[model samples]
Target: MLDLLNDLLWGKVLIGLLIAVGIGFTLGSRFVQFRYFGRMFRILGASQAFKRDKHGHLSSFQALLLSVAGRVGGGNIAGVAVAITLGGPGAIFWMWLVGLMGMATSYLECTLAQAYKTAQPDGTYRGGPAYYIARGLGQRWKWLAALYSVLLLVTFGFGFTALQSYAVATSFDDAFGIPVVFTGLGMAVIVGLIIFGGIKRIARVAEVLVPVMAVGYLLIAVVVLGMNLPRIPEVFLLIVNSAFGLEPAIGGSIGAAIMMGVKRGLFSNEAGLGSAPNVAAVAYVPHPANQGIVQAFSVFLDTLVICSATAFIILLSGAYDPASGADIGGVALTQVSLADHVGEWGRSFVSVALLLFGFSTILYNYYLGENSLNFFSESNVTLFNLFRIAVVVLCAWGAMTDLGTVFAFADVTMGFLALANLIALLMLFKPGLRIMRDFDEQIRAGIRHPVFDAKKFADLDIDPAAWEIEPEDIERLKRYGAPPPSASQPVK
Candidate 1:
């Protein structure tokens, strides 16, 4: 049943849905991805919303790390390899194309998450398709929200996390002859330590680790590209040529290339999958669109940066035989490719990379699972605790299993999750657009630093605390020598 459903959803329906939405959103949002691409960096470097408050919730930068932790993971490596193997090297062109348009889709979904967010008594926030569907669309849509939560729980919470662990285990297995079960147990312990510390720990770890791994991986890719300097132009040509069936070396149909690329790109960057917005909503940004732009940049980082690095590494090493690689897609292929180019040490380097990438992704998945259960009731402590255990157990179990089956199951559930989110996004898009307009108008008015006013949106379901700024809190922060209000986190 799952295979059949996955075949239909991934091969046919979701492809068009994803593409159409990406294009529509790209145009509708006035090229938000490109227009504000530079601003993403400005926010990253200058934004002071990264301070740790008394609560466990993360700041904007930490939230970006959390989201990136999920976005730039095993999928960026193994998943891209799978796409290239099945779809041909031309597949990367299609991935780039999807990524180009996905920025707008990411902005829309994330902005909606911020606008419709609800604050909990614990001074934390929770929002996503579930929250927005219920609050923005009305209580009549509560069932749809719950359905989304269930799908997300299955998709990110369990299935996808398992795949990350599986990739880690396989990489280690290929590298050191480490047994899968042992790797699984080790992974479970590491995951339990961080996840038990909750979102704060995850964010803290991500803020530090994500940048290091991403930059290190890119640096290695640049080094690899230098080693194959003459092949650089040829690599670009092959990608474009294969995408359009102009390259006969691929020996595959253009349709296969398009489908595989879109699938892997969607899974890797998670632009419209409705997963990132759950974390995006948790961020304490001055404007909802601020987080939207940050996450839009994240899509670029995931597909254009990390995944591209993996593709280049594999292609440059000349390790991927289209015919043979199709049967052996995933981290092992990457490990071999790096080894072929760099040396015997390449295998060990990739294993360590996989461990960090996959472990961070597991943290992302666990966070999403807790939010999913909380969607039903934040006070459901039993469900939350049990789900945490399930995540740890499944993370271990997944490492011991074949990942081909794991990826397929995740695709099916994610298909449904995206469908729910896309529908809600279209229906509730105006509020997000309104928020974007507010952001744009502020920029135009020379506000240099935009501060959101919750009272201006009294009609929406936004939690007032999210926009509220207490004088004493300001004094406390100032006394600690906290920086000025960032354009991301403005003072009231």
Candidate 2:
């Protein structure tokens, strides 16, 4: 039944929808992802990106790191191997395509998330597909919002985190002979410590650890690729040939390549899957598009940079042969390939890297669940604590269980989650376009940094408290004296 559902959802429906939506967003926004590609790095270096305040809200950079934590996980390593095993080396090319197109899709969804975000009592923010679907699309469509929240809770909160736990436990068991049960229990305990401290704690941890683990893993890939520099051109040619069926290899058909690449690509970067926007909404940015652009870069980092690293390591080591019939795959395939290059130490490094990746992802996934749960009830402390306990138990259970069923379940839920978000995005398309236009107009008008004016969007359902202009912003507007209807005054 699970296999049949996956076949129906992924094989037929989502592959086309994912590509079409990505292209639509890219064209509709005039390729905002690329237009502001260089600007993204500039925004990251801005002082606002790291600023914290009396309110415990996340800075723009912290939000980016948190979302990156969610994107770079077991999928970058183990999931890439699975794509190669089932879809051949050509799958890497399709993954690259998805990552590129996904940049636009991520930008649109996350920008909408920021536009519709609400201020919470604890001085934090809350928004995502759930908030936007209900508020942006009107109250009559709140059922759709509830549905999105439920799917997010299931997909990220339980299913994906459980899978992360399973990956880490299995890696330790393979590398150090550690029992899966012991690894599972230890991970669950650590998770409990951070989650109980709340979103602030999660943000702090992700900001510190995400960059370290991602850089460390990429450095290892660099060394391995450098050692085999002569084969770099050959590997690139093989990927392109296999992608177009110019080369004969296992699972080398164009259809299989497109399907597996897209599936695993979405799993890795989560561009249109609606997960990243949950954290994206938490950021404090002058313009909603600022955070959106930051998130689009994250998809690039996850699939293009990190996932490609894993692909090169596996393909270059010759541990994964399309011509040969061998059963090696997943994290083990990656471990074997690395070990081939650097001996047994490489295997242990992968085990440790996966532990950090999976651990950070668990932190990210748990926050998504908590945010979704808040949609139904904000003050239900009892229910919140119980949900946390349930997640901890699921983490431990997933580590010890066979993952066939769990993985299937996660794929199905993820498909539905993306389906819901894409529909909401399409419905709210014009408003999203207007938001982007607002930012563009500001930049074109000689404002070096765009600041959102809620009065300009009075027709929308945005919370004024979330976009209240700061006194510093008022001063900055005074300095720019070029436009009528100053930012401080209401637009007539």
Candidate 3:
């Protein structure tokens, strides 16, 4: 069953759909991501409404941190190595291309998440692909919502939960001579403590750890790239030629390049996967667009900055070769590449990095599963907790299984969920555009602010308007902030 699933999903059908959705979003949104690039960075770096919230759950930076925690995980290390192994160096180029367009898709989906966000009874916010599917497309298609919930629970909770643990276990075994099973047990206990405390604790951990780790890894990559600076031009040519199957740097063929690039690129950045939006909706800020832009910038950070860093390090280290055995994938592959540059200690460092990256992703994925459960009932906390514990057990179990099968299951399930999410994005494009226009109008007018405030959404009927954003109040998000809802189209 798993093999069949891999055959069906890892082929052209899934790749085409993923690429098509990215293109559709880019075209549909009038390339808002590119047009507003400077504005997005300005909003992320500013500091003002750090504490304000109408019915707040997390600060803008906290939200960014949570989303980054998920994106910059095991995938960056293991996934990229795996991508290059199968897809060749050219795959790097394809990954970059998808990320470029994927920013728009992420913006649209996350904006819709904010647009239809539901206010929690505990004065918090909850929204994701499921919420948008139900509300944006109307409540009649409850099955769509239900299906999304189920897929998320399985893909994230069961499939990905275990995948993360397995990465941690493998890394520990390789670096410290520790048993994989005990490592899994340790991981479960840590996860249990943090998750039991809920999103706030998770957000706190992510906020502190994510930035430090991301910069640390990037610095390492810089060192590797600097060492091999002279060969940079040749590497660039190889990447381009391989992407087109002309250079054959890694057995140049269009099929190999496209497949490897698309697969790894999608896995690394997850631009169309619909996971980041879950975190994006919880930000305490003004306008769905505010969070949407933040989410898009994340894709840039993930693929353009972070993933690019990984590719440069691996390629420049001279450790990966298509004709040789050095083309290792995933965590092990990255360890090999890093070790080549930094020596034996580099393997230990890579292992530690993988542990942090994979653990943070598991934290975020669990939070997403928690939100999906909310669609059923707001107070099913105990059942969700149990489910998460079970996930921990499976994570341990996954450590002893075949990695190829483990990844295959995760890949197929994740692809299916992304398909559903992209469909939702396609259907909600019109409404998302209207919200963007509405937000821009409000920002241009002096009446609106940029932080979370229900007043900004009072005259608006969009479900996400359930809470309003105040422009003057949001920290790290002031430049593009808007004030109260404008009079242009007051809710009837």
Global Cα RMSD, each model: 3.5, 2.4, 3.4
* Candidate 3 wrong stretches, greater than 4 Å: 46-48, 51-56, 325-327, 400-406, 442-461, 469-492
Task: Please report how far candidate 1 places residue 87 from its true position, in Å.
Answer: 1.6
The number of the candidate with the highest TM-score is: 2
Candidates ranked by TM-score: 2, 1, 3
lDDT of 3 by residue, 1-492 (tens): 877777677576667777887787678667888877777755655423454445445766788888889888877877777677777788888888988887888888888788778766555688888888887777676788888888887788778888788878888898999999888878878888888887878887887789888988988888888888898898888788888878745744677777777777777777777888888878755567878888888888988888888777788775777687543577777777888988878889888888888889889888888887877877686887787678667766877666677677777778788878877777777877877776666556652344333344444345533564333343223343433344432221
lDDT of 1 by residue, 71-136 (tens): 888788778988888888888998998888888899899988888888766656788878889888
lDDT of 2 by residue, 167-214 (tens): 899889989999999999998898988888888888888878998999
lDDT score, candidate 2, position 462: 87
For every model shown, the clashing-pair count is 0, 0, 25
Report the CA-based lDDT of candidate 3 relative to the real structure: 0.75
RMSD of 3: 3.4
Against the reference, the lDDT scores of all candidates come to 0.82, 0.87, 0.75
Give model 1's TM-score versus the native structure.
0.92
Better of 1 and 2 by TM-score: 2
User: What C-alpha lDDT, on a 0 to 100 scale, does residue 2 get in candidate 1?
Assistant: 85
Please report, as a residue range, the 10-residue window in candidate 3 with the lowest summed lDDT.
Answer: 483-492
Displacement of the residue 408 alpha carbon in candidate 3, Å: 3.2
For candidate 1, the C-alpha RMSD (Å) to the true structure equals 3.5
Q: Which pairs of residues collide in candidate 1?
A: none
